[model samples]
Target: RVRFRDPAGATRTGEWTDAIECDGRSYDPAAVEVLPPCEPTKVVCVGRNYVAHADERGADVPDRPLLFLKPPNAVAGHGATVTLPTGVAGNRIEHEVELGAVVGERCRDVDPAEATGVLAGYTVVNDLSNRDDQRRETNWVRGKAFDGAAPMGPVLATPEEVPDDATVECRVDGEIRQRASREQMVFSVPELVSEVSRFLTLEPGDVIATGTPEGVGPVKDGDRLELTVDGVGTLQHTVRA
Candidate 1:
């Protein structure tokens, strides 16, 4: 599904195929301003859910999922230009391509076997990071939860559309920076969802970001980033210094 601004400046949600279909009229996707497919109350992110990513940071992967939170204010839509914090010297802002799971309802203590039943769909999320602040702060609130920190959407695909081992990747200015299969995640989507629900009730529209693979790096001003998740489609955004 796609959420976009219609020609009349109204926000609309529609099914996306060769074109966007809504109310019996097809729309050229490029002609409309794409919005974040869902308005997440909170974005729960997994850290080091990939072995190679943990190795890159020289940190030990936890037996259980390592999690972080990015509040609603951090959410940004496709085609948005995210501003990097430049107050600190040597600030290293980076892009982390991730697959996002949108919750379908409010629930707690979900069983892994039944996790899929609570999912609305899947979408692409760029977990924007301020490495300089992240390395210093324990909670990473300043590092990960800044305004427009999570660039998401363009499409939300149902569970049936995405394969179990779909590819997720990030390209900066047309260069492939990160690429891996969803199967590479140390914790699967269902496992992550179940674990998170065990800690807090996941309300509908909340998103679970399943973590990034290796090759995460910086994005400078004027850089165009394309984050893609197989079956969901690509999320494009730019960075501003």
Candidate 2:
């Protein structure tokens, strides 16, 4: 099932019947325009949520979740092109596909068991990065806070439809780059929700990026990205100047 939030601020939920309709024509899911299901107040991300991913990048594992934020202006639709800024020279951009959680209700200091209840649904997220810039500054904001860096969607899937333990995989040009079950997460969805809620109040439409697995690398102009979560759907996009 595909759940989408219309531009009018109303929610429109639909199933993948024959094809997705837009502008009076049918197109593949990847070709459709998308919108953020929620006008998020903040985009919270968990760093090193996956063990292998942390080790691959030569980063130490954290005892607790590591958090960061991406500005709201950085968000864009799934099919949107992410422009590389001229100011950041010699920077390599990487793609990190994550399973994003959408909060349904206001919550703070929520318990793990109750975390799942607060989730409105799930969506695909591509956390783009400037690796060289990141290493140079040792700060993530400049590396990740680029316009169109977070290309998310096709639509959202309610928890009732997509189980909490879905499989997430990311492919580039039809080659599998990252694969893992939700069960493999060092921190489960509910646990992450509970942990983040303790520090800040999660309001309706707020998003939490659960984190990406290993196999993350760089993508160049003209490269294609295909991110899929079983039972949810696939989101495809191309890199461009």
Candidate 3:
């Protein structure tokens, strides 16, 4: 598990086994600063890597893999508030729970069999989206690349601590919305690392957000999004106006 200073300037860590009191702090769990598990230069994400998710959206399953990027500035720590952009009235907002791979070592042209050796850890990530904006613009930048849109953490767990094929699930307001096993992924973690590294160098701390599963849907203000990757931890955030 990782440690972080909440908005109230208190150093709280998820590794601990007890509840942490806020002590009347004005901080909202939905709005907090995020620091990288390790310093990273890039965040690479796979799109539609799950056949069921791709089919649900009428997107074709890729022959290889579709990838995208989220700038480092877009990273938000656990409990960070995700804001809905002004005047994006008709856009639908959705929560995507994904298993994020944290690279532990720098690599280039890595072999799939050796990819796990380079992994630093794992973290739960919510890949927030604005569907209308994405569909209309023909580019994902504006839709998926927004401030605090990528809420990750609670803590990063070392590979030895988390079994590679853990289950990943997403819930909104205590109700399960998306569920899938890592075993269902069209591409394995090692394959992702090997494929991604073939195109670009991967540095320690760089994160690769493996694609979400089926059951993608809308969310609104005041809703709490809980993402859990077994053996890692749960990451919670609330939507705000």
Candidate 4:
């Protein structure tokens, strides 16, 4: 389900049937461009927050959260075509699909027990990366924060609607590449929020990509990438060279 404005600018909420008519009104989804569901101050991401993901990369599981930031320039809406920077040699772009937690209010040093109260909703995000640039530089800002690197939304799901143990999956060109249960997370969402809150203040709409599961791989031009959260929704993007 989605809450959006019609081309006429009237706000409405209902099932996203992807059809021309919604609630007795005929409108084309393609004609009325859907914007990113949230406007975040920053997009914070967790690294190796999943045990299987850490193990797959031969990296030690962190005792605490490994946090990273993807600049606002990276944000993109559903149906966007992510461009490959021509200057970067051996671009080796890859997708790290994960569940995105959207903050609902300003918070600092929040109690983990009350973390859920600050969440606006959850959505899907494809954490696009330049693996070659990442492997060559210690800092991944240049690798992960490129324009259109993060494709999010289609819609947002309330926290109450998403179970803690929801399934997250990624598919490339219709083939499943990564799959796991949220229960495999090394740090739960509340714990992650609390950990991040210890240092950075989270405002309404600030997003946290709760890391990815195993099976991350490279994507090439013309590939279709889809990130799906069991209770959230699928966010799809096209790769462009």
Query: Candidate 1: where is the Cα deviation over 4 Å?
Result: none
Q: Would you estimate the TM-scores of all the predictions?
A: 0.97, 0.87, 0.88, 0.91
Model 3: CA > 4 A from native:
6-14, 19-39
Q: Candidate 2, residue 206: CA error in Å? A: 1.2
**C-alpha RMSD by candidate, in order:** 1.0, 3.4, 4.1, 2.4
Residue 78's lDDT within candidate 1 is 87
The per-model lDDT (C-alpha) reads 0.93, 0.79, 0.81, 0.85
lDDT of 2: 0.79
Candidate 3 vs. truth: CA RMSD?
Answer: 4.1
Question: What is candidate 3's TM-score against the reference?
Answer: 0.88
| Number of the top-ranking candidate, with lDDT as the measure | 1
Model 1, position 27, has a per-residue lDDT of 93
Q: Write the per-residue lDDT of candidate 3 for residues 66-152, one digit (tens) a residue.
A: 888888766887676778766664868888999999998889999999999999888888888878887878668878887777878
lDDT of 4 at 33: 53
| Ranking of all candidate structures by their TM-score, best first | 1, 4, 3, 2
Residue 53 in model 2: lDDT: 94
Clashing pairs in 2: none
